[model samples]
Target: MMHQMRAETGPDGATDSVVSWHIVRNADLTALCGKTLSTAAPVQDATRWTLDPDRNCHTCGALFLREAPYFPDEHTD
Candidate 1:
């Protein structure tokens, strides 16, 4: 699992607004040397949630969508 976090200011003048996403991927083993491999879907740009809805994983060469965009705890340190 991987995590992506973004912070934005809301209309109420709060800069603590944040959006987080959980990225899940699969792992595979190479047949030749038995090396474990993993991949996370690659996005073209920073605005992936809006621009690249469907992207390809650079490592495993699979297709996946970003999911669970939510706010994290404000008190997180």
Candidate 2:
């Protein structure tokens, strides 16, 4: 099966606020591609809990809304 380009963001009230996904084609080119292309869904842009796993700093372990965003990297932008 061919996988179409898709993007999804964390649900509302979700502890994880990080945006995920990759850009497939530009908006102008998406139509020409003949495939349903999607972009990263934007959240409320509020401070939400995020956690990084010990294995990888780029990975999120867990997140608790209203708690704290924790990461093994010790820093985040």
Q: TM-scores across all candidates?
A: 0.17, 0.21
Question: CA lDDT of each candidate?
Answer: 0.27, 0.28
lDDT of 1 by residue, 11-77 (tens): 4333333222222322222211222222222212222433333332232221223232333443379
TM-score of 2: 0.21
Candidate 1 ranges beyond 4 A from true positions: 5-22, 25-47, 56-77
In model 1, pairs of residues that clash are: none
Task: State residue 50's C-alpha deviation in candidate 2, in Å.
Answer: 21
- For model 2, residues 1-77, the per-residue Cα lDDT tens digits are 11122223345522445344222222321322233323444322122222222221121212121123333356845
> Where does model 2 exceed 4 Å of error?
1-7, 13-16, 28-77
Q: How many clashing residue pairs are found in candidate 2?
A: 0
